[model samples]
Target: MSDKPLAPAIEGWHTMGDQPHLIGTRCTACGTYFFPKQSHYCKNPDCDSTDFEEVELSRTGTVWSYTNACYEPPAPFVAPQPFEPYAIAAVQLEAEQMVVLGQVVTGVDTEQLSVGMPVELVLETLHETDDDIKVTWKWKPVAA
Candidate 1:
Protein backbone atom coordinates (compact mmCIF):
# COMPACT_ATOMS: atom_id res chain seq x y z
CA MET A 1 0.00 0.00 0.00
CA SER A 2 1.19 3.50 -0.82
CA ASP A 3 0.68 6.71 1.06
CA LYS A 4 0.84 8.74 -2.13
CA PRO A 5 -2.39 10.24 -3.40
CA LEU A 6 -4.21 7.75 -5.60
CA ALA A 7 -4.72 8.45 -9.29
CA PRO A 8 -6.02 6.37 -12.15
CA ALA A 9 -3.40 4.84 -14.43
CA ILE A 10 -5.65 5.52 -17.40
CA GLU A 11 -7.90 8.41 -16.52
CA GLY A 12 -11.65 8.23 -17.24
CA TRP A 13 -11.58 4.50 -17.99
CA HIS A 14 -12.96 3.40 -14.65
CA THR A 15 -14.14 4.67 -11.28
CA MET A 16 -12.19 4.56 -7.99
CA GLY A 17 -12.83 3.54 -4.39
CA ASP A 18 -14.17 0.53 -2.44
CA GLN A 19 -16.64 -0.20 -5.20
CA PRO A 20 -15.02 0.81 -8.46
CA HIS A 21 -16.78 0.28 -11.80
CA LEU A 22 -15.61 0.39 -15.39
CA ILE A 23 -17.01 3.42 -17.18
CA GLY A 24 -18.45 2.65 -20.59
CA THR A 25 -20.98 4.00 -23.03
CA ARG A 26 -24.29 2.65 -24.22
CA CYS A 27 -25.68 3.14 -27.68
CA THR A 28 -28.91 5.06 -27.21
CA ALA A 29 -30.56 3.43 -30.23
CA CYS A 30 -29.81 -0.26 -29.94
CA GLY A 31 -28.99 -0.39 -26.20
CA THR A 32 -25.54 -1.76 -26.93
CA TYR A 33 -22.70 -1.27 -24.48
CA PHE A 34 -19.05 -0.58 -25.22
CA PHE A 35 -16.02 -0.23 -23.01
CA PRO A 36 -13.35 2.46 -23.48
CA LYS A 37 -16.36 4.76 -23.71
CA GLN A 38 -17.53 4.67 -27.30
CA SER A 39 -19.03 8.09 -27.87
CA HIS A 40 -18.01 8.48 -31.49
CA TYR A 41 -20.38 6.03 -33.14
CA CYS A 42 -22.08 2.74 -32.52
CA LYS A 43 -20.32 -0.33 -33.93
CA ASN A 44 -23.63 -2.12 -34.25
CA PRO A 45 -24.05 -2.82 -37.97
CA ASP A 46 -27.74 -2.05 -38.08
CA CYS A 47 -27.43 1.21 -36.23
CA ASP A 48 -25.78 4.26 -37.74
CA SER A 49 -26.75 6.41 -34.78
CA THR A 50 -24.06 8.55 -33.24
CA ASP A 51 -25.89 9.02 -30.00
CA PHE A 52 -24.44 7.53 -26.82
CA GLU A 53 -24.63 7.95 -23.06
CA GLU A 54 -22.07 7.21 -20.39
CA VAL A 55 -22.83 4.39 -18.00
CA GLU A 56 -20.96 2.65 -15.19
CA LEU A 57 -20.58 -0.93 -16.34
CA SER A 58 -21.28 -3.82 -14.02
CA ARG A 59 -18.64 -4.66 -11.42
CA THR A 60 -19.48 -8.35 -11.22
CA GLY A 61 -19.22 -10.89 -14.02
CA THR A 62 -18.28 -14.40 -15.05
CA VAL A 63 -14.84 -15.18 -16.38
CA TRP A 64 -15.16 -15.78 -20.11
CA SER A 65 -11.46 -16.54 -20.51
CA TYR A 66 -8.05 -16.23 -18.84
CA THR A 67 -4.34 -16.00 -19.68
CA ASN A 68 -1.04 -14.76 -18.26
CA ALA A 69 1.41 -12.05 -19.25
CA CYS A 70 4.90 -13.48 -18.84
CA TYR A 71 6.74 -10.37 -19.89
CA GLU A 72 6.51 -6.63 -19.67
CA PRO A 73 4.21 -5.13 -22.28
CA PRO A 74 4.71 -2.04 -24.40
CA ALA A 75 4.21 1.52 -23.28
CA PRO A 76 1.20 2.82 -21.36
CA PHE A 77 1.88 -0.15 -19.10
CA VAL A 78 4.48 0.55 -16.42
CA ALA A 79 5.89 -2.76 -15.29
CA PRO A 80 7.71 -3.14 -12.01
CA GLN A 81 11.39 -3.99 -11.83
CA PRO A 82 11.96 -7.73 -12.29
CA PHE A 83 8.42 -7.98 -13.55
CA GLU A 84 6.32 -10.85 -12.31
CA PRO A 85 3.90 -12.69 -14.53
CA TYR A 86 0.29 -11.68 -14.02
CA ALA A 87 -3.01 -13.27 -14.89
CA ILE A 88 -5.39 -11.64 -17.36
CA ALA A 89 -9.06 -12.40 -17.73
CA ALA A 90 -11.86 -11.60 -20.10
CA VAL A 91 -14.97 -11.31 -17.99
CA GLN A 92 -18.49 -11.08 -19.36
CA LEU A 93 -20.27 -8.45 -17.33
CA GLU A 94 -23.49 -9.41 -15.62
CA ALA A 95 -25.44 -6.39 -16.82
CA GLU A 96 -23.88 -5.58 -20.17
CA GLN A 97 -23.55 -9.14 -21.45
CA MET A 98 -20.22 -8.15 -22.96
CA VAL A 99 -16.72 -9.34 -22.20
CA VAL A 100 -14.22 -6.79 -20.91
CA LEU A 101 -10.57 -7.65 -20.41
CA GLY A 102 -8.61 -6.78 -17.25
CA GLN A 103 -5.69 -7.90 -15.15
CA VAL A 104 -6.39 -10.31 -12.37
CA VAL A 105 -5.45 -9.45 -8.80
CA THR A 106 -1.92 -10.16 -7.64
CA GLY A 107 -1.13 -13.73 -6.52
CA VAL A 108 -4.13 -15.42 -8.13
CA ASP A 109 -3.05 -18.58 -9.92
CA THR A 110 -4.04 -19.52 -13.47
CA GLU A 111 -5.15 -22.95 -12.26
CA GLN A 112 -7.62 -21.24 -9.94
CA LEU A 113 -9.44 -19.60 -12.82
CA SER A 114 -12.01 -21.19 -15.09
CA VAL A 115 -14.54 -20.26 -17.72
CA GLY A 116 -17.78 -19.00 -16.13
CA MET A 117 -16.06 -18.35 -12.78
CA PRO A 118 -17.58 -15.34 -11.05
CA VAL A 119 -15.47 -12.25 -10.56
CA GLU A 120 -15.74 -8.63 -9.50
CA LEU A 121 -13.87 -5.43 -10.16
CA VAL A 122 -11.46 -4.12 -7.57
CA LEU A 123 -8.90 -1.34 -7.44
CA GLU A 124 -5.22 -2.02 -6.95
CA THR A 125 -1.98 -0.14 -7.24
CA LEU A 126 -0.65 -0.73 -10.75
CA HIS A 127 2.51 1.26 -10.24
CA GLU A 128 3.81 4.36 -8.52
CA THR A 129 4.88 7.76 -9.78
CA ASP A 130 6.68 10.63 -8.18
CA ASP A 131 3.43 12.45 -7.42
CA ASP A 132 0.82 9.73 -7.07
CA ILE A 133 -0.03 6.07 -6.64
CA LYS A 134 -1.24 4.88 -10.01
CA VAL A 135 -4.28 2.68 -9.56
CA THR A 136 -6.11 0.49 -12.02
CA TRP A 137 -9.01 -1.95 -12.15
CA LYS A 138 -8.39 -5.67 -11.65
CA TRP A 139 -10.60 -8.73 -11.72
CA LYS A 140 -10.80 -10.68 -8.43
CA PRO A 141 -12.46 -14.01 -8.07
CA VAL A 142 -15.63 -14.03 -6.04
CA ALA A 143 -15.12 -16.40 -3.14
CA ALA A 144 -17.59 -19.23 -3.20
Candidate 2:
Protein backbone atom coordinates (compact mmCIF):
# COMPACT_ATOMS: atom_id res chain seq x y z
CA MET A 1 0.00 0.00 0.00
CA SER A 2 1.10 3.55 -0.64
CA ASP A 3 2.23 5.74 2.26
CA LYS A 4 0.08 8.73 1.31
CA PRO A 5 -2.99 9.41 3.44
CA LEU A 6 -6.39 8.36 2.16
CA ALA A 7 -8.84 10.67 0.42
CA PRO A 8 -10.49 13.45 2.41
CA ALA A 9 -13.64 12.66 4.34
CA ILE A 10 -15.47 15.10 2.13
CA GLU A 11 -14.25 15.31 -1.43
CA GLY A 12 -14.01 18.54 -3.48
CA TRP A 13 -14.09 20.76 -0.42
CA HIS A 14 -10.41 21.33 0.08
CA THR A 15 -6.87 20.07 -0.55
CA MET A 16 -4.25 19.35 2.11
CA GLY A 17 -1.69 22.08 2.57
CA ASP A 18 0.13 24.42 4.96
CA GLN A 19 -2.38 27.05 3.77
CA PRO A 20 -5.48 25.16 2.76
CA HIS A 21 -8.53 26.98 1.46
CA LEU A 22 -12.00 25.64 0.90
CA ILE A 23 -12.93 25.00 -2.74
CA GLY A 24 -16.19 26.56 -3.82
CA THR A 25 -18.07 27.63 -6.92
CA ARG A 26 -18.87 31.19 -7.93
CA CYS A 27 -21.54 32.37 -10.30
CA THR A 28 -20.33 34.35 -13.25
CA ALA A 29 -23.83 35.72 -13.73
CA CYS A 30 -24.54 37.31 -10.36
CA GLY A 31 -21.31 36.80 -8.43
CA THR A 32 -22.88 34.36 -5.99
CA TYR A 33 -20.54 31.94 -4.24
CA PHE A 34 -21.32 28.53 -2.85
CA PHE A 35 -19.42 26.12 -0.64
CA PRO A 36 -19.34 22.41 -1.50
CA LYS A 37 -19.81 23.87 -4.98
CA GLN A 38 -22.95 24.06 -7.06
CA SER A 39 -21.97 22.57 -10.36
CA HIS A 40 -25.45 22.67 -11.90
CA TYR A 41 -26.69 26.14 -11.14
CA CYS A 42 -26.35 29.26 -9.03
CA LYS A 43 -28.16 29.29 -5.69
CA ASN A 44 -29.24 32.91 -5.73
CA PRO A 45 -32.98 33.17 -6.12
CA ASP A 46 -32.77 36.16 -8.38
CA CYS A 47 -30.26 34.51 -10.68
CA ASP A 48 -31.28 31.72 -13.01
CA SER A 49 -27.90 31.15 -14.63
CA THR A 50 -26.30 27.73 -15.02
CA ASP A 51 -22.80 29.10 -15.57
CA PHE A 52 -20.33 28.79 -12.69
CA GLU A 53 -16.60 28.79 -12.12
CA GLU A 54 -14.64 26.92 -9.47
CA VAL A 55 -12.77 29.10 -7.01
CA GLU A 56 -10.80 28.67 -3.82
CA LEU A 57 -12.56 30.37 -0.91
CA SER A 58 -10.73 32.72 1.38
CA ARG A 59 -8.61 31.17 4.14
CA THR A 60 -9.51 33.75 6.78
CA GLY A 61 -12.92 34.56 8.15
CA THR A 62 -14.60 35.95 11.24
CA VAL A 63 -16.35 33.65 13.67
CA TRP A 64 -20.07 34.17 13.16
CA SER A 65 -21.09 31.80 15.97
CA TYR A 66 -19.79 28.91 18.05
CA THR A 67 -20.88 26.15 20.41
CA ASN A 68 -19.44 23.28 22.38
CA ALA A 69 -20.57 19.68 22.00
CA CYS A 70 -20.86 18.34 25.51
CA TYR A 71 -22.00 14.90 24.41
CA GLU A 72 -21.15 12.18 21.94
CA PRO A 73 -22.34 12.87 18.42
CA PRO A 74 -24.68 10.58 16.50
CA ALA A 75 -23.58 7.72 14.25
CA PRO A 76 -21.24 8.26 11.25
CA PHE A 77 -19.38 10.58 13.60
CA VAL A 78 -16.68 8.49 15.23
CA ALA A 79 -15.37 9.83 18.51
CA PRO A 80 -12.51 8.50 20.55
CA GLN A 81 -13.28 5.64 22.91
CA PRO A 82 -12.89 7.93 25.88
CA PHE A 83 -15.04 10.68 24.52
CA GLU A 84 -14.31 14.34 25.14
CA PRO A 85 -16.39 17.39 24.28
CA TYR A 86 -15.40 19.46 21.26
CA ALA A 87 -16.18 22.91 19.98
CA ILE A 88 -17.82 23.78 16.64
CA ALA A 89 -17.82 27.11 14.93
CA ALA A 90 -19.64 28.88 12.12
CA VAL A 91 -17.12 31.01 10.34
CA GLN A 92 -18.13 33.70 7.86
CA LEU A 93 -15.90 33.91 4.81
CA GLU A 94 -15.58 37.59 4.01
CA ALA A 95 -15.33 37.50 0.25
CA GLU A 96 -17.83 34.70 -0.16
CA GLN A 97 -20.29 36.27 2.27
CA MET A 98 -21.18 32.85 3.52
CA VAL A 99 -20.71 30.90 6.73
CA VAL A 100 -19.28 27.40 6.87
CA LEU A 101 -19.53 25.18 9.93
CA GLY A 102 -16.67 22.97 11.07
CA GLN A 103 -15.05 21.54 14.20
CA VAL A 104 -12.57 23.75 15.98
CA VAL A 105 -8.99 22.64 16.32
CA THR A 106 -8.26 20.56 19.41
CA GLY A 107 -7.68 22.36 22.74
CA VAL A 108 -9.87 25.37 21.89
CA ASP A 109 -12.87 25.42 24.16
CA THR A 110 -16.00 27.55 24.16
CA GLU A 111 -14.46 29.71 26.87
CA GLN A 112 -11.62 30.71 24.58
CA LEU A 113 -13.65 31.70 21.55
CA SER A 114 -15.69 34.77 20.69
CA VAL A 115 -17.82 35.90 17.78
CA GLY A 116 -16.03 38.01 15.17
CA MET A 117 -12.64 36.53 16.01
CA PRO A 118 -10.44 35.63 13.05
CA VAL A 119 -10.09 31.98 12.10
CA GLU A 120 -8.34 29.92 9.45
CA LEU A 121 -8.86 26.56 7.81
CA VAL A 122 -6.71 23.60 8.86
CA LEU A 123 -6.43 19.94 7.99
CA GLU A 124 -6.60 17.40 10.82
CA THR A 125 -6.92 13.69 11.27
CA LEU A 126 -10.44 12.50 11.90
CA HIS A 127 -9.87 8.78 12.26
CA GLU A 128 -7.35 6.12 11.35
CA THR A 129 -7.23 2.45 10.53
CA ASP A 130 -4.46 -0.04 9.84
CA ASP A 131 -4.36 0.96 6.22
CA ASP A 132 -5.22 4.66 6.06
CA ILE A 133 -6.14 7.76 7.99
CA LYS A 134 -9.24 9.80 7.32
CA VAL A 135 -8.70 13.54 7.22
CA THR A 136 -11.07 16.52 7.47
CA TRP A 137 -10.91 20.28 7.58
CA LYS A 138 -11.25 22.23 10.81
CA TRP A 139 -11.38 25.81 11.98
CA LYS A 140 -8.74 27.24 14.28
CA PRO A 141 -8.59 30.59 15.98
CA VAL A 142 -5.96 32.85 14.53
CA ALA A 143 -3.35 34.39 16.82
CA ALA A 144 -3.34 38.15 16.97
Candidate 3:
Protein backbone atom coordinates (compact mmCIF):
# COMPACT_ATOMS: atom_id res chain seq x y z
CA MET A 1 0.00 0.00 0.00
CA SER A 2 1.11 3.53 -0.68
CA ASP A 3 2.06 5.82 2.14
CA LYS A 4 -1.24 7.64 1.66
CA PRO A 5 -3.36 8.05 4.73
CA LEU A 6 -6.16 5.60 5.36
CA ALA A 7 -9.35 6.43 3.48
CA PRO A 8 -12.85 5.05 3.35
CA ALA A 9 -13.61 2.68 0.50
CA ILE A 10 -17.00 4.35 0.06
CA GLU A 11 -17.01 7.87 1.32
CA GLY A 12 -19.92 9.32 3.32
CA TRP A 13 -21.21 5.91 4.31
CA HIS A 14 -19.22 5.26 7.47
CA THR A 15 -16.70 6.92 9.69
CA MET A 16 -13.10 5.87 10.55
CA GLY A 17 -11.58 5.35 13.99
CA ASP A 18 -11.28 2.88 16.88
CA GLN A 19 -15.05 3.25 17.08
CA PRO A 20 -16.79 3.51 13.71
CA HIS A 21 -20.43 3.95 12.83
CA LEU A 22 -22.47 3.54 9.68
CA ILE A 23 -23.75 6.86 8.53
CA GLY A 24 -27.48 6.57 7.90
CA THR A 25 -30.30 8.97 7.41
CA ARG A 26 -33.40 9.01 9.59
CA CYS A 27 -36.74 10.36 8.48
CA THR A 28 -37.68 13.36 10.57
CA ALA A 29 -41.33 12.35 10.61
CA CYS A 30 -41.35 8.68 11.53
CA GLY A 31 -37.79 8.21 12.88
CA THR A 32 -37.06 5.46 10.39
CA TYR A 33 -33.40 4.82 9.63
CA PHE A 34 -32.02 4.19 6.15
CA PHE A 35 -28.69 2.50 5.50
CA PRO A 36 -27.87 3.70 2.01
CA LYS A 37 -29.31 6.93 3.23
CA GLN A 38 -32.40 8.30 1.52
CA SER A 39 -32.33 12.00 0.82
CA HIS A 40 -35.38 12.12 -1.38
CA TYR A 41 -38.95 11.08 -0.50
CA CYS A 42 -39.59 9.29 2.75
CA LYS A 43 -40.50 5.64 2.29
CA ASN A 44 -42.66 5.44 5.37
CA PRO A 45 -46.30 5.23 4.25
CA ASP A 46 -47.66 6.87 7.38
CA CYS A 47 -45.22 9.75 7.26
CA ASP A 48 -45.10 12.16 4.36
CA SER A 49 -42.40 14.46 5.68
CA THR A 50 -39.42 14.71 3.37
CA ASP A 51 -36.98 16.03 5.93
CA PHE A 52 -34.11 13.80 7.05
CA GLU A 53 -30.93 14.10 9.08
CA GLU A 54 -27.80 12.04 9.00
CA VAL A 55 -27.21 9.94 12.07
CA GLU A 56 -24.54 7.52 13.26
CA LEU A 57 -26.15 4.14 13.58
CA SER A 58 -25.46 1.70 16.41
CA ARG A 59 -22.03 0.07 16.27
CA THR A 60 -23.13 -3.14 17.96
CA GLY A 61 -25.66 -5.77 17.00
CA THR A 62 -26.45 -9.47 17.14
CA VAL A 63 -25.82 -11.99 14.39
CA TRP A 64 -29.17 -12.63 12.75
CA SER A 65 -27.74 -14.87 10.01
CA TYR A 66 -24.44 -15.80 8.43
CA THR A 67 -22.90 -17.76 5.57
CA ASN A 68 -19.63 -18.61 3.88
CA ALA A 69 -18.60 -16.99 0.58
CA CYS A 70 -16.50 -19.58 -1.16
CA TYR A 71 -16.32 -18.02 -4.60
CA GLU A 72 -14.86 -14.82 -5.89
CA PRO A 73 -17.38 -12.01 -6.18
CA PRO A 74 -18.05 -10.60 -9.63
CA ALA A 75 -18.09 -7.04 -10.91
CA PRO A 76 -17.01 -3.67 -9.43
CA PHE A 77 -15.75 -5.44 -6.28
CA VAL A 78 -12.01 -5.87 -5.83
CA ALA A 79 -11.10 -9.34 -4.69
CA PRO A 80 -7.65 -10.14 -3.42
CA GLN A 81 -5.49 -12.57 -5.32
CA PRO A 82 -5.78 -16.32 -4.46
CA PHE A 83 -9.46 -15.78 -3.70
CA GLU A 84 -9.63 -16.29 0.03
CA PRO A 85 -13.03 -17.41 1.23
CA TYR A 86 -14.64 -15.40 3.98
CA ALA A 87 -17.68 -15.43 6.18
CA ILE A 88 -20.40 -12.83 5.84
CA ALA A 89 -23.22 -12.04 8.21
CA ALA A 90 -26.41 -10.07 8.47
CA VAL A 91 -26.53 -8.39 11.85
CA GLN A 92 -29.56 -6.67 13.33
CA LEU A 93 -28.81 -3.30 14.82
CA GLU A 94 -29.40 -2.96 18.54
CA ALA A 95 -31.74 0.00 18.30
CA GLU A 96 -32.95 0.16 14.72
CA GLN A 97 -33.64 -3.57 14.51
CA MET A 98 -32.71 -3.48 10.82
CA VAL A 99 -30.41 -6.07 9.36
CA VAL A 100 -27.22 -4.84 7.69
CA LEU A 101 -24.94 -7.29 5.95
CA GLY A 102 -21.13 -7.19 6.00
CA GLN A 103 -18.10 -9.42 5.85
CA VAL A 104 -16.95 -10.80 9.16
CA VAL A 105 -13.41 -9.93 10.14
CA THR A 106 -10.65 -12.23 8.94
CA GLY A 107 -10.00 -15.51 10.84
CA VAL A 108 -13.48 -16.12 12.33
CA ASP A 109 -15.68 -18.35 10.25
CA THR A 110 -19.25 -19.71 10.16
CA GLU A 111 -18.39 -22.44 12.64
CA GLN A 112 -17.31 -19.81 15.12
CA LEU A 113 -20.42 -17.69 14.77
CA SER A 114 -23.99 -18.28 15.86
CA VAL A 115 -27.28 -16.43 15.58
CA GLY A 116 -27.98 -13.90 18.35
CA MET A 117 -24.24 -13.66 19.12
CA PRO A 118 -23.23 -10.08 19.71
CA VAL A 119 -20.96 -8.34 17.25
CA GLU A 120 -19.54 -4.89 16.84
CA LEU A 121 -18.65 -2.63 13.95
CA VAL A 122 -15.00 -2.37 13.03
CA LEU A 123 -12.87 -1.02 10.19
CA GLU A 124 -10.90 -3.38 7.99
CA THR A 125 -8.89 -3.16 4.83
CA LEU A 126 -11.19 -3.82 1.87
CA HIS A 127 -8.57 -3.56 -0.85
CA GLU A 128 -5.38 -1.67 -1.43
CA THR A 129 -4.53 0.58 -4.32
CA ASP A 130 -1.47 2.65 -5.05
CA ASP A 131 -3.48 5.66 -3.98
CA ASP A 132 -4.46 4.61 -0.48
CA ILE A 133 -5.53 1.79 1.80
CA LYS A 134 -9.25 1.58 1.31
CA VAL A 135 -10.93 0.73 4.59
CA THR A 136 -14.50 -0.40 5.16
CA TRP A 137 -16.68 -1.35 8.11
CA LYS A 138 -16.92 -5.01 9.11
CA TRP A 139 -18.74 -7.02 11.77
CA LYS A 140 -16.74 -9.06 14.28
CA PRO A 141 -17.65 -11.02 17.35
CA VAL A 142 -17.69 -8.74 20.36
CA ALA A 143 -15.66 -11.23 22.37
CA ALA A 144 -13.07 -11.72 19.67
Q: Rate the local accuracy (lDDT) of all candidates.
A: 0.93, 0.88, 0.92
Model 3: per-residue Cα lDDT over 1-144, one tens digit each: 467779999999998999999999999889999998997888888888889999999999999999989999896779999989999999999788699999999999999999999999999999988888999989999985
Q: In candidate 3, list every pair of residues with a backbone clash.
A: none
Clashing pairs in 2: none
Candidate 2's clash total is 0
Comparison by lDDT, 1 against 2, better one: 1
- Would you give me the overall lDDT of model 3? 0.92
Better of 1 and 3 by lDDT: 1
Give me the runs in candidate 3 sitting further than 4 Å from their true place. Answer: none
Candidate achieving the largest TM-score: 3
By summed lDDT, which 10 consecutive residues of candidate 2 come out lowest? 1-10
Candidate 3 TM-score versus the reference? 0.95
Q: What is the lDDT of candidate 1?
A: 0.93
Q: Distance from true position, residue 5, model 3, in Å?
A: 1.9
lDDT of 2: 0.88
Which predicted model would earn the best lDDT? 1
The 10-residue segment of model 3 with minimum total lDDT is: 1-10
Steric clash pairs (candidate 1): none
